[model samples]
Target: MLIREATEADWPVIWPFFHDITAAGETFTYPFDLGRDEARGWWLLPPPDRTVVAVDEAGTVLGTAKMNANHHGNGAHVASASYMVDPAHRHRGVGRALCEHTLQWAREQGYRAMQFNAVVETNLPAVALYRSLGFEVLGTLPEGFRHPRHGYVGLHIMHRAL
Candidate 1:
């Protein structure tokens, strides 16, 4: 698979799965009814922030990741990121590859560490992946996320030093 910076033209390809994922309300905290324009504004970040997509040999987008400083000014040294893998392409290492790529990018950009602010506790696959990649569960906010089927679930704050 090829992982590279995403271009504006890629948005159309990305939005379908992005909308599906967010609407599922299984992982991401984005509003279920989030509109295209608002989603675009959030995903297609500019400048010091970076976004990338992973594609197969046929050039089909398999997954995407966005990375940026977790906060500005005093907290700028730490980075944060989000990832989404096409449902049709799950369990094929696409998410892992996207994560590895994002980590490399973060290191290259001089980030001191990376933090995930609101990882859903029930998203076991992602939480496991992050732990395997050296992230630690810093803490969990009790019943922080309202999962569609699971009622209120904990939100994990995970961290890793770059």
Candidate 2:
């Protein structure tokens, strides 16, 4: 799949999976009821940060990622990123490709480290993927998320040096 900078036009195609993923209320911390316009703003980040989509040869956007500084000023050296893969495309390496791309981008941007602030502990596939990519869990907030099916679950703070 080809990973490239996302364009405004991609929003329409992206919104469907994005909405489904968020509405699932099983992984992301975003409000399940978050509106489309607000989600567009949140996912399609501004300059200095980046938003990208991974597409197949047919140009089907299979996944997306948004990356930026974890914090401003003193914390600017650290980076952060979030990913969303079309559910139909899971187990096909779309998420892994997006993650590897983010790591490369972070390194190229001179970020000292990258952090994922809210990885749901019950999302075992993601947890394992992050681990395979060298991200370590710094800590977990007990009962941090109210998963739709699992009740309360821990939220992990995962990190790795670039």
Candidate 3:
């Protein structure tokens, strides 16, 4: 597999899984009925911010990630990132590769640390992956996320120094 910068053309392929994942209401906070244009605007960030895709040898996109400042001005030194892997591609290291790529990008860009503002506590795979990558749960906001099937669950604030 190869990791490379994402392009506008990749949105069409990404939308299917992106929509499926968000609509599941299991992890991401995006509205279940989020539209394509709105999602495109949110995922395809502009310069200074970065978006990338993990593709197979045949060039099939397996996953994607977007990284940027967690906050502006005085808070810009800290970075944040989001990842989405094709459900069909889970457990194949797609998510991990995207995360590793994002971390490298953040470090190269001079970020002092990386923080995830709203990680659903129930997303065990993600929580484990982040932990394995050296991120720690700083705290959890109790009943912060209203999971579709699990009712209210905590949202973990995870962080790690670069």
Relative to the true structure, candidate 2 reaches a TM of 0.99
Against the correct fold, how does model 1 do in TM-score? 0.99
lDDT for model 1: 0.95
lDDT (CA) for every model shown? 0.95, 0.96, 0.97
The Cα error of candidate 1 at residue 38, in Å, is: 1.2
Model 3 agreement with the true structure over 71-120: per-residue lDDT tens digits: 99999999999999999999999999999999999999999999999999
The window of 10 residues in a row where model 2 has the poorest summed lDDT is: 83-92
Tell me the deviation in Å of residue 28 in model 1. Answer: 0.8
TM-scores of the models, in the order given: 0.99, 0.99, 0.99
**Models sorted by lDDT, best on top:** 3, 2, 1
Candidate 1 segments whose C-alpha is farther than 4 A from its true place: none
lDDT, candidate 2, 48-150, per-residue tens: 9999999999999999999999999999999999999998888899999999999999999999999999999999999999999999999999999999999
Residue pairs whose backbone atoms clash in candidate 3: none
